[model samples]
Target: MKMIKTAFCLGLVWGASAYADPELHFVDLQEFNAALDAIEAGESPLSAMESYVAQASPVFQAYAQRYETSAASIADAYSERPGYYRSLPELEGYIRLREPEIVSALSRLEAMAPAGEVVPTYFMVADQRAGGTPVLAAGAAGPQINIAVAVDMIALTAETDMSEFPGGTGGRAEASDLPQVVIHENAHVLQLAAQGGLEAYRSIYSPEGGNMLAVAVREGCAEYLTYLASGWRLGDRHVYGEANERALWSEFEAVMDAPPFSVPGWFSGRHPDHADWPAQIGYWMGFRICEYHHQSAADSDAAVRDLFTLYRPDDLRPLAEAYGASLSAN
Candidate 1:
C-alpha cells in the first residue's frame, strides 16, 4: 500500500513538475467543442484526439513495473482517487495524469523496437468502447493488434457486458467484422509514424473524403498484421463452413479477385471498390509488401528501419496496376 501510494504521488508530482504550466497537455477546450460541433455537422473526430497519451494502461504498467508501478498497482492506487469511482469522469483525469510517462515510454520503445516485429505488445486491447477514441500503446499501435473476444460480440444479443453484445448485431460490429476497425485504427498510427506526409490524402479525397489506396494500405496492413501477429484471418471466416483447404482457398481466391468494396465482413467504400475486408486486403497486400521488405532486409532490426520506406504509395499502386499481383493470388 505504501509503495503504491508513493508511486501514485510520484506520478502526480511528475505531471505537476513537468508542467510549470498547469495547462500542459490541455486540449483547447475549444477543439473538443469543435469536434462535437463537427460531429453535429456530420464530421467524425475518429482521429482528431482531444489529447494523446502515449502510455496506454499496458504501457504504463510495463513502464511502472520496470521503473515505477505496475498496471495492477496503478489500478489499485486509483481506488483512492475520487474520479475513478463507479461513475468515473467521462474523460478520466488519472488516465490523463499518466499521459506524459506513457508518451515518453512509447518514444523510447520506438528507438529499440525491431522492424517487422509486432508493436511492443503492451498497447492492445480486444474490446474498447464503440465510437470511442483509438489508443496507441507500442510502435504506433504497430500495424496490428491482439484481437480476442471481440469477433464474437456482434453475433450474440441476449446477454450483456463481457459475456455478450448489449444491442446485438444491430448494435455495432459483427464478429467477423470487428477486426476491420481494429486494424484500421492501428494502421493510422503506423502510417502516421512511418511517414507524416498526408498531402496525398488531401489530393485523393475531398475535404469530405479520404484516399482509398491509402486507406487500403492502412487498413490492409492492419488486417495483414493482425493475422501475421495472431494468425486469425477474419477473411478466413468467409469460408468457415468449408472443410477442405482446396475449396476454402478457392473461395478466398475468388474474394480476392472480386473488388472488396462493400463486402460485409471486409470493406465499406464502393467508389474505390473498398471491401468489407478492407483491412484484410491490407493484410493480403500489406503483408506481402512487409514480408517482401522484411525478407529483403539484411537483419531483423532492419525490418523496423525500413517500415517508413514501405509507406510510399508507389509500392501499393502496383497491386492495382498492370502486372501487379492479382488480389486473388497468394
Candidate 2:
C-alpha cells in the first residue's frame, strides 16, 4: 500500500487541484502496441519490452514498478506464449474499437463518484493478477491514486487460448466487459480514498491478519457498487452464488473468519472444498452482506457511502451476522 514512485512519459506532477474531472489515459496501450510492432520488425523482445515500460503512462509505469517483473522475465513470458502474444494485434484493435463505448461507461461513473473526487484511470498492457487494479503513481508534486486496467487481458474472452501462458487465465474478460471492470476498480480506489489512502486501507483490511471478512467486504462493496453504477453484475460468481445461496452461505459462514491462506479457495482463486463450487465465492458472500446491509438500512444512500467510510472488519461483523440470522430464520 506504500506509494510507489514511477517515471512517467510526461513530467507533469500529480496535483488534484489542477484537474476539473477524472482523467483517462490510453498511452500505455499505444506504447505496448509500438513494442509489438518493434518485436515484429526483428527487434529483440527484451529491448522492445523495456522500451514499452520506459514509455508507458504514469499509472501503468507505476503498475510495472510495483507488480511486474524484469523485462527478461516478460520477454520469456512472451516467448513461451507466442500464441497469446500473436493475438495481441487483434486484441488491441478490438479494444480500440470499443474505446468510445468504454469512455461513455466511464463517464457514467463520474456522476456516481464522491463529490470533487478525481480517480484517474489508465488503460494499459501489463502483466497483472487481475484485469484492473488500484495503483499509486507519484511525481514531484505528490502521490496520485489511479486505476490501471490491463486492456490486453480484459480483451480476452472464454475462448481465448491461455494454456501456454505462465498464469492460467482465471479471470478472462471480453472487451465489452471493460466498463464494469473499470468501474469496479474505480470503486476500489474510492474505498482507499475514503479511509485516507491505500496504506491506511491496508492497515485495517489485511488477509495476513486473518481478517478475511474485511477483505471480502472490501471486494464485495466494490462489486456491489459496480452493479449500482452499471447494471451489470461483476461476474458469473453472483449467478452461481444466487443459485446456491443457502448452501454457499452455510460453507462460507464457517471460514469467512478463518485465515484465508489456510483455506486457499475463498479468495485465492483455488478450487473450493466442494468440487462443485467456483473459486472466489467469498466475493458473493461479501456482496450478499453489503447488499443486505444496503437493503435493510433506513438510508440506502448512507449505507452505500458507509461501505467506503467504514474501516473495521468488526464494522461489517454485525451485517454478516444479521444476514446469517435472517438466513437461519428462513
Candidate 3:
C-alpha cells in the first residue's frame, strides 16, 4: 500500500502546548500524477483514471461527476491536447516544491475559519481545460472539496512570453501562488457549507428569485474571505492594479441599484468589451461590501461568521450601500 502523506503545519508553540494543526489529504495528487505519467508513456489513461475515481470518497466522486464531464471525454481532451500532458511533470514538480508552504497556508486558513466550517475531504486532480484558475466543487452530501488543477495552463502562464497562448492575459498566474488559489477556493467551500449545502445554493438561482446581486454577494464574500484567510488581496491579483479598482468601484457605485438582470454584462464578465475592465469586477465589488460589513461590526469574528451566512441579495445590498457611503465620507 502506498503511504498517503498528510500535510501538517506546526502551530504556534506556547511553552510546549502547541495548537492542533489542520490536516489536508493529498492522496489524489499521487494517484492523479500516476495517471498523467501513464498517458505520457503512451498508455491509455482511462484505466488509471477510472481506478482513481472508483477509489475516491463518495463525496469526492459526486463532486467530480458534478463539475467534470465524463472521464472518457476528459481522457480524449488530454489526448488531443498533447501539450497538457507534456506539462504534467513541471506541474507535479511545482506542487512538490511548494508542499510545505501550501500545507502551512492551509493550516493558517483552517485556524482562521469558524469552528465546524472547514471542509475535511480535499481532492486535487488534473484537468487540462481549467486554465490557471482551479475549479472547486463542493459535495452536496459531505464536507468535501474537489479541485482540478490545469497543468498546461499553469505552464503556459509560467512562460515569460505568452504571445502564443490563447486567453494568455486571463490565464496568467504564478505557480508559486497556488497556495493562495487553494485558499480562495477553500473560502468558497466554507461559503457553500454556510448556505445550507449546494441544493439551497442552487435554489437561489430560480428565475424569479435570481439576481445579479446574488452572484456578486456569493463571489464577493469568497473573494473577501480569501484575503482574510491568506492576506492576499484580490485587488492586487491579475491585471487589476490599484487604479483599476478605484475606477471600477466608482463605476459600480454609480449604478449599483440598477437591476442586476438589466445589466448582465456589468455584473458578470460575459461581455467582450469587458476585456478592458478588470477581470471579475463583481468579485471586487462584493469584497468591498463584505469589508465594510466587517469593519462596521462590533465583533469582527462574529461579523465574518454572519457574512458567510448571507445568501440573499437583499441582505447584501445594504452592506454594499454602506460601503458606498463610507467611500463618499472618505
TM per candidate comes to 0.35, 0.84, 0.70
What lDDT tens digits, residue by residue, belong to model 3 across residues 1-330? Answer: 000011111221111122234444556556667777776676776775676566655434544544464467556655555554445455556666766766666666656555323333343454543432222333343233333343343454344444334454453445555555566666665565565544444433433544666666666776677777667654343356345656666766665555554554454345454566655567667776787799899998888886677766677678777776777787
Q: Rate the local accuracy (lDDT) of all candidates.
A: 0.32, 0.67, 0.54
lDDT of 1 at 295: 54
Off by over 4 Å in 1: 1-187, 197-213, 225-266, 269-312, 318-330
lDDT of 3: 0.54
Q: Which candidate is the best by TM-score?
A: 2
Each prediction's number of clashing residue pairs = 19, 0, 0
**Ranked candidates (TM-score, high to low):** 2, 3, 1
- Residues 82-139, model 2: lDDT tens digits: 6666565455466567556555655565456553254667787655445677676764
Model 3 spans > 4 angstroms off: 1-21, 44-60, 89-93, 96-100, 111-115, 121-123, 126-157, 160-164, 167-172, 192-210, 233-241, 250-269, 296-298
Worst 10 residues of 3 by lDDT: 1-10
Which run of 10 residues does model 2 get worst, by summed lDDT? 1-10
Residue 69 of model 2 has an lDDT of 48
lDDT of 3 at 234: 40
TM-score of 3: 0.70
Best by lDDT: 2
